[model samples]
Target: MAHLFKVDRVRLLCSCGVLKPITAIYFCRHCLKLRCGNCVSHEVDTLFCPNCLENMPSTEARLKKNRCANCFDCPSCCHTLSTRATSIQAPSPEDSNKTVARKVYYLACTSCRWTSRDVGLKDQTVATGGWSEQDNEHYKYLQSLLEHYRSVAQQEKLDRERKRFSHRKSAYLSLTDKYSLPSLLGRKSLTPLSPYAPKGDSSQSLDMTASEATAEVEGLPDEIFTEEVVLSSVTDMEQRMASPEWQPEKTSDLYPLHKHILVKRSLRCRHCEHNLSKPEYNPSSIKFKIQLGAFYHVPEVRMIRQVELKSEVETCVQVSLCNPTPHDMTLAFLPFVPEAYTAMQQKVEEPTDGGSLNTSSMVRVVDIPPEKTDLTPSADVALPQGQVILAARDDTAEYDDQDSISSYKDDPLVVAWRRANKVGINLLVTPKANVSRAKVGFVLRYDYTNTVATASESRTVTLNIPVMVDVGTVSE
Candidate 1:
């Protein structure tokens, strides 16, 4: 049956119990496990201005409040604001004094046709630095509070260390009692050792003015209702929200807002602390230096069509599998059970005391990813027992299709047809009548050839990947 609605075309089950699209998943080469957005740790790679495309260090970015000093975003349309310069006649200093016209720079939004003059801002001699800056209202108080909390935490840590070994008063009283050595006039330690004193200023006095609340409230001005409101003259809610610190209401109070900086992120697998994706250091480059996405490594499975799907009734669905590697792969669909995964992991981690058994399995695949999770297949999917051979990806074969042909026999039941490295697979899907919607899931176990370098230089390894298929809503 055809899907009744449009959803994620393909949603793969992550090891962390997340059902995400194949594009959003990552394949860790080191661990040989699939990682999702929630499972991996994200770290900012580079901080750059999206408008200017200029990169800065983390310290500089933080000092500038993660914003670009030269770039500004329009308050009204949220577009990049351009610095415009105009030659205006300078005002005469006095009756006898003569003045000359000078070119001054001001911020203007090209999209909304908003000029800095609308906000009563005077033109600046310099294009970037002369703009006025307002200090955060609660910055000082917040810093003081942060310092107080830090000192308190530090003191508590010191107290914990001091009390960790001995909490008794005698241990801290005197060296004579602690060491059980009496002072001798003839010989001994030259002078009695004094208790170590941390020589540093411990406490700092803070003068903070607490905010006071009043019962009396001020009402809105009468002019608000009496005066005619012009939408162009007044700032909108979104415009005010751009600069949340100020949130000025009047157009005259709308100042040039700093453009927020964008960051490049690097993803790492939390379980093994391995890099799953990392971009080049150059901000202008768009390619990744080391990206191990599932799309490039994992066998791509996409739903072609569902023939018949109903409650308790068996159906046939066609799913296409495309091999992305350079070497041929033997694919087999199997039942996705937790116990099966555990058994495989046990075989991978058999205890070895440097015996023959340990030496034999030393060249085998190592990482055993976590398989126990909340995500499970809702529908029953019968897998094919026969091994499906998929040809290796050939770039030149795409042009010369007739010249390149594989000799592997295709199964009429499981494999509908084969084209280059891609294969069309047909599998049996049965939906349980207990639920309202039909969902089918299974596992793809393949004989993968790991080309990664190792001490043993072994290539063949078995891999299991979870597969999920959405069969759409069941019939009444």
Candidate 2:
């Protein structure tokens, strides 16, 4: 209870060897192991603009430097800039005699009340595109650099392809390029290089001027030491760092920045390759496409109440256990001891680079460390020693007055309270002596039924889970 701010007392140890809350962990149905954020792999599902909520393709987002086209952020405040419209009366082009009213737009910040006019930016006749955009001064040189690198990469790829192709006997020169009608009809001819084959771009080179580093450094201003520093007139670090390409040092040079693109990612289990969490592609839709959270799959355990815990002394601790599954469960409690991470502490997923390591060498190599669970128990728990039967979940049973009361008889020492699929149980916790705050742990062995259709036999599988509870020091 009241564990929002402080949850170290009730952290659960994941398979990866990490201690975390159940809400932060995931249960892979295939592996049946607790996965924390560290052990899962994150794959970007969609790129979107957080400001405009517009979905963008990966290629388009890359081309735009992963920034939104329509949305802009205030340079001064770093807040989203809103388009403020003002009505202006102007002479109509078609009817010169008549004065027509039209709306003009300018970027403004609601938080700081900074407007485009403050920075000497002109109001636009049209809202979006009429705003002035700063082009990179070395645009041509940058394009040439890109072309030069692309050609070099292409040539390297071509060389690698040729080397690979020369060794293969299945690959043959194109018939159209090597053989002519005359050769097919009578005369034999030597094969020429195929026209479709990649050739080196001899003309591709950098178009910019070359310069080497010199001993001389650029001189600072003559009045640098004497000049007065005005904080309001200078841009903050955030404003300058907002646009990395042009880090404006002064407020006068500050410009509206394009909003950076946001991405939705899907998490997958590393062991079984099962999707743990997947979000919908639509930016506006908040619902998830597939979310297999540990909270929904595993039995949630929470500390309800605990008696005084003296060092090497017997104490009573009350905890509420809820079965998230829809089927009836035969629950058992157990102690969990946390150990060091061989593969980072459980809950953390191993990162994959989308490539397999070459294992054909003299020694087989693998990146991830082995899993280690050889941890000493911090505390001990006294269990019911037998199976605790819990009935299947009934949604309507909560509202029914007749069914609201539990008919199942419970042992006085074990079951403190029971409602629906949730049961409150009391267990004796004994902590090690001299340890100020010893964490008591238990191993819960339960009978779980595998309902997956691919399973050969739908039978009750015994599952053992380790749980830990924090017990503070008790006075003599």
lDDT of 2 by residue, 1-476 (tens): 46422556666667766667788888777777787776676667888999889999866886787899989999888899999999889899899999999899999999999888888888899878677678878787767766666655545544544654566443322122111122222111212232255475466444446668899999998877899999998888988888777888889888888989998988777666678888998998889988878777667777776467777887888877788778888887654534433334434344343223211111112224335543455557676666677766777767867546667767878998888888888888777766666576777677666555655665667877666666555544
How big is the positional error of residue 125 in model 1, measured in Å on the Cα after superposition?
3.8
Off by over 4 Å in 1: 1-7, 89-102, 135-236, 306-308, 338-376, 401-406, 434-436
Residue 106 displacement in candidate 2 (angstroms):
1.4
**lDDT (tens digit, per residue) of candidate 1 on 1-476:** 24522335556667655567788899876677778776675667888999889999866876687899889887778888888888888766564367778789998999988877887788888877678876779777767776665555444433433453244332211111111112231112321221132522265324445669999899999999999998777888888898888888987788888899998888767556667888997888999988888888888887776455677787787888889888889998877675543443333232222122211101222234545433445568778778999888888877873745558787688887788898998877777867666666678887667767776755677788877667666664
lDDT of 1 at 378: 55
How many clashing residue pairs appear in each of the predictions shown? 2, 21
- Model 1: lDDT of residue 139: 77
Cα error of candidate 2 at position 408, Å = 3.1
Candidate closest to the true structure, highest TM-score: 1
